[model samples]
Target: METVEDVTRMHLVGGNLALDFVNTRTGPPVGPSDDDVLTGYPELVAWGAYAGVLTTSEAAALRRLSRDDPDGADATLSRALRTRDHLDEIFRPLAAGGAPSTSALARLRDDEADALGHAQLEGGSTYAWVWRADRTLARPLRPVVHAAVQLLTAGALDRVKGCGGCRFLFVDESKNRSRRWCSMDDCGTAEKMRRYVAARRVRARR
Candidate 1:
């Protein structure tokens, strides 16, 4: 039973807005960090890769977007959203069998194949650039977007959001509506420790 808030904080497949949408922390320990996003893209791309086919250019573009930047990060972020939205819309109808035409699917498949070919050529014979998106060490977009789409059509894109506490994107699989950190083993534990110390001080004062 994932709430909107929980879902918002756990997934980020598309854009920076996706990360902002999931910001739920109220203290110094809240909000996704730039580092979180820098690391998270690999996971999200991996998830997209598992969901369907990703062209070498698209994967390369994603890697380029992830490079360290300040003023230009916004443009990179915009490109990411554009690419993601394109994929999401393309798949939206595919998963629905909308209009009963294989034309759309065939075209997309062909385009992906062509792009992949060019990407491999430009990236060199080894296709090593394709794997650049995988080196960030962030949690990969698990089970991929296509798999998620296969489960349901036309769901809110915001469900795929970044961490409220960090840029790490994850699927909110909480059962108690209590997930508010990037990782329970990290932010969550730190939060509990702070609260415990605060409580102890209050008792000592009394």
Candidate 2:
């Protein structure tokens, strides 16, 4: 039942790539459901392109590579989801002023190291992570792991928030730092209607 528009509507409002990655799954803050938008390798590659982690040509190449090596593609998708879950465990607490678990940190460390191993120096001073156009199934995850590292190390952890309705993670970059919903067009409107109905019911009772 997924349409092109629905797939294209993947939330990018997290303000941070890694937080956006975690928002792929839709659910509550504590119990995010299994409704992952990246349902397959092609979807994952499309999301990578959408996230700016992969160029259009790179996404096309990855699609061809995945078609050729289904097993590798499956493994890569599994790794990507696992990485997202680890990030959820790590960042959720940090956003709440608590420390991440040692296990979660260890997983992130391993992902970061893996991502680094495939990188190459590009433009003399800037390092560009390169995954083989043919076989590097996990190439898309490198940038995501890097983004998570940046957010964790920077002073931006305090701005991370979960949407009040859907629990999607987003960075509250508002001037007042009072952002609460994942998107005003979606969860925000739904929440507003719920409150309006509740207030009307109270008035009717009175």
Candidate 3:
């Protein structure tokens, strides 16, 4: 298992916020995941800050609030974890060229609506949805929720893929859509080394 001390190592290679959010934990190509980095509310907020989902002040404020209201922090943590799992259920299947359950889609829609309820539109040339400024514990997660909506509505589901090396989710944004690893410096290099050793063994046996 990867020794993920904190969200600083989430890798942030998903190329999209929703995908990055779902990858807070990792699994195998055909099994369950045991590596979870976001162990609690503070870690969740740290991840949001690391992923650029939360501003520095927002992150600091959330941490301060967590100290004052531990129960509320725990509740927000539960919500964040649930949201992450909810996203995994929706995106994992889609990454493997399968459709997510209808119920999952419905739940995602409802979640988006709930997030948008706290949003206010503002702009000069073109307006866009922006979260209402507040110190609520759930603020860190609102951007993630909106990102899920954006990824779903963007109409490029085909680009989403599960990495051939580590089963991490990412979008194949290459011009030819041929990206196969979450990181060439990590998974890609490891895979190549494995193949190289295997090839050497085969030649030695001959």
Q: Rank the candidates by lDDT, best first.
A: 3, 2, 1
- Using TM-score as the measure, the top candidate is 3
Better of 1 and 3 by TM-score: 3
> In order, what lDDT does every prediction score?
0.39, 0.83, 0.84
Cα lDDT of model 2 by residue, 1-206, tens digit:
44334557876888988988888877766664857687888888888888888888888888888999999999998989999999999878876778889999999999998887887656566665555432487888998998898888874778887788886888888999998888999899999999999999999999
- Which pairs of residues clash in candidate 2, taking residues 3 or more apart in a chain or in different chains? none
Candidate 1's TM-score reads 0.33
Q: Estimate each model's TM-score.
A: 0.33, 0.89, 0.94
Can you tell me which runs of candidate 2 are displaced by over 4 Å? 1-5, 123-135
Angstrom error at residue 2, model 2: 4.9
TM-score rank order = 3, 2, 1
lDDT of 3 by residue, 14-93 (tens): 98898898888876756888678778887888888898877888888989999999999999988888888888888889
Summed over model 2, clashes come to 0
